[model samples]
Target: MVISPQEEPSPLLREDDRETAVQRLQEAYADERVSHEEMEERLDQVLTAKTHSELASALASLPGENPDTTSTIAAAGGRIHRGGTWRVPRILKVESAYGRVDLDLSRAVIEHPAVDIELQLGTGGAKITVPRDAIVEVEGLHTGWKDLRYKPPRRARSGGPRIRISGAMGFGRLKIRHARR
Candidate 1:
């Protein structure tokens, strides 16, 4: 889901988010992109950023993030729904606490032959719809309350992308199915 900058509750991110940003900045420093003084200045900006835009600008020159990078979808009590035509990253991390998740990847552009999905849900269920030719594997997932239900296609297509899902679900059930033709 895309959230406009104005619709955001608070532009300030959580402590963990700041920590991650700091780590990224440190990585950039290690890459020798800037002098020590410039790195320190950018770190200060990141640490003192008051809004999302400010923080983003602090790391705008960094050459780390890209479209194919691992993307994380997180929610704290809200729903996460993704569908339509979108670029599928190599690795996806889906996280939620009390909200449901729905991912429709039938029409998504899967560039890689293998994709990894790591789920972290608490008291919420998820429904994933994969392409008709994709192969899914959920053997590494663990559920606290209920088991997962996944229905595969009758005729599996070889050479398709492999979706590997692994994670823990608390008091929730996961349902996976292939998209209808």
Candidate 2:
């Protein structure tokens, strides 16, 4: 057979080399780098991608960034004080291995003069210490166990910090203490 100089390669040959761009995008999403909005947008773009190059481009344009571990640790390991009823809009995530969280924020004073604390923990222990004279009112406490312990009160309202500990995997101990009366 003789080949013609004007002949061209078949376009169907390129289809076998096509990449699974949508699958790659899903993998990126599972890695927790891409936001929900970005994931949805990329998925839409990926579905409309006609060629491998176009799909690859869409994946490359995604703003997928991993979380910084140092900053997460610093945020998880600090103390905050408020003069009035303070509210921290964050769910503390402590690993099950650590099994213990010790916070010393008794110096915090609220407008009602009552220290209101709300501890929401998973499968770990929580021990919070307050000032001996500060009034303690625990709004809610959720954990994995029911081993709630409190130190003897030396002040008028320091007898015991009002608390509420409850959760699905409650298997931890909670202790409260104060030095002065």
Candidate 3:
């Protein structure tokens, strides 16, 4: 839904919300949807806005992240880990043949309402830590040796992150968990 000009952001808006807005602005700028000057101006507004309408105003005119954009991280062997604060891509593919993969999304800037993660692993196992409210699905995943180590919530609330995981792996266990409150 579009955020109208007069609509105010919640006073309880978290830093994560602001960071998501900023990430979207940067994505739009990178795609040439906005000129450099517009990017700079909106970035200033986003950085200064705190429980203020400026944040909404700055983001009101920007388009959402490109739906077709996909990013990949590949490791021939060793380890691959993503944590801390990072932008969550609409689609992400991770591949590793002989090492562990640990991805922690508890503190990520997830601009999109849904995200897809495709994994290809071997021997070393994997662990994915998602936001507490994320709704996760692994219907299309195939594991060679062990069953995936994820248990979905009985019921998920509306309007949280939707994560779809699909891929194939051999000789490793895949584990998923939501971040603790």
Candidate 4:
């Protein structure tokens, strides 16, 4: 009744798996268990992981992640700002209704090389700041009578994080800019 490794079904790496690995790396970075360069390298591996084994290897040296991890911010008729040394989750979901949401990743600690941001903006604005070397990709954003402006990255460079933003912005503007540094 035992299944061989080849006969067993291989676990496909999913977005959630990548997120969990990144979260573990973030915690390790916070606990000083991994240096900045090591964190970045591990994050890259996590994002580009193709199989469950690869994903597991990314966080194998780190502590286990919380099974019930949540990294979502909802702003209803108010302002929500995330900046300054905050840990960037692997998949950050922001929901705003008649409010503003600002995310500054200039000095923030990013755990994933490819971060996915799910935004639901309504009659509100969002300003996101990332490092100059990072890559910003916006998708699935449809605005009505409003503007979503941002200087797209020239090209994806090696060893730089890629921010994949996907959401709907209604009558709200979303601006992505590079850090002043």
Candidate 5:
């Protein structure tokens, strides 16, 4: 069965979700986008997904975006990172040890209403989903970095929150699913 983005929690990811996430990750492995070791490492995270958004977020990081990928993830509670170029319809000035990061969220809704505002990292990726009508605001930077990529499954649309990459590391591929509606 297809799980709705809003149904997920945070922090602690569940195991059942791992089953579904593994299937999707396998597609990336098959495409040679990710190595077998990476797949296994990511799969371990998904299986432990406590929230649906976390599971979806993990899936977003996968290499491939095949239509046939099957994912069923469960979440308990924890943190999630949103990745992409930082930009928001409204600008929120943020400063920190890592650096200043801008949030571009004029077109986002919180997949989960009970959770805190969207958190961005300075040099990592994030994956978050919201309900159909909650406006997502920039709360703060969870972490930050350069070079972010997000690729979602065929049935999904919109990438999650955007993050600014430092561009220090060589170019790499990161897939983030912003929205799936």
Candidate 6:
């Protein structure tokens, strides 16, 4: 049976679905399937998409996503940096020993309503950058000889991701900051 556009199933797209679509669009743009202007336009639509059909339309002609993946990064006496238009995993574990880590999630495509970040900091420091609209909560944070510093979100956003960061820092600093627009 052929379904008309109006008759198509248009379930509401969850925040996670929208994020995934945005990530796919970004990948398409990077692969040159879509132009810069088209990517920006699709991204805007994805951010404001209200229904599954709308989100699907935004990612139309794009490549399919791979299976869900998790990432773990360990730094030993070196610097670990993750930035650019990468996909944010549902769970991320970072371990640093006498090294530094920088995780920038401003342009990341977050596929979950809540992202879990586990950090193991030792004589090293970490800097986490997130979107200004995201809600960030650092729990069970213990720092010795340093501090975990971040300005509490002024107000929680309805459809933004929540970053739950929990970890220990010894002789190191953990700073959570908003991304510069």
Task: Give the candidate number with the greatest TM-score.
Answer: 3
Q: Which residue pairs does candidate 1 place in steric collision?
A: none
Instruction: Give the count of colliding residue pairs in each prediction.
Output: 0, 13, 0, 0, 61, 0
Candidate 5 ranges beyond 4 A from true positions:
1-17, 64-181
The per-residue C-alpha lDDT of model 1 at residue 138 equals 92
Q: Ten residues in a row with the worst lDDT in model 3? A: 1-10
State which candidate, 2 or 4, has the greater TM-score.
Answer: 4
lDDT of 2 by residue, 17-59 (tens): 2334555567778887687788888878766655434444466
Worst 10 residues of 6 by lDDT: 1-10
Model 4: lDDT to the true structure: 0.71
| Best-matching candidate per lDDT | 3
TM-score for each model = 0.63, 0.36, 0.65, 0.61, 0.30, 0.62
Writing each residue's lDDT as its tens digit, candidate 5 over 1-181 gives: 0234443323344443455457657767888888878878777767665655556566554444432332222122232322221112222222122322322221222222222322223333333443222333333332233434444344533333333322221222223333333
Tell me the tens digit of each residue's lDDT in model 3 across 1-181.
Answer: 2122333324445676677777878888889999899999888888887654455567764665454589999999999987644567899999998999999886565678889999988778999998767889897898999888987766665666898999999989999997763
Cα lDDT of model 4 by residue, 20-60, tens digit: 56776887899888889999999998888776555555665
The global C-alpha lDDT for each of the candidates, from Candidate 1 onward, is 0.76, 0.43, 0.77, 0.71, 0.38, 0.73
* lDDT at residue 152 of model 5 (Cα atoms): 32
Candidate 2, residue 114: how far the Cα is off, in Å: 3.1
Positional deviation of 14 in candidate 1, in angstroms? Answer: 35
Candidate 2, superposed: residue stretches over 4 Å from native: 1-98, 109-112, 138-144, 152-169
- Residues 64-169 of candidate 6: C-alpha lDDT, one tens digit per residue: 4442565788867799887644567788888888888899886555667888899888887889998766788888778888878898767654556888998788
**Model 1: CA > 4 A from native:** 1-68
Q: Please give, for residues 1-181, the per-residue lDDT of candidate 1 as tens digits.
A: 1222453335555564466567767877788766688889988987897765566567665655454688999999889987643457899999999989999876455678888989999988999988767799997899999999987877887766899999899988999988763
With a 3 Å backbone cut-off (N, CA, C), the pairs that clash in candidate 3 are none
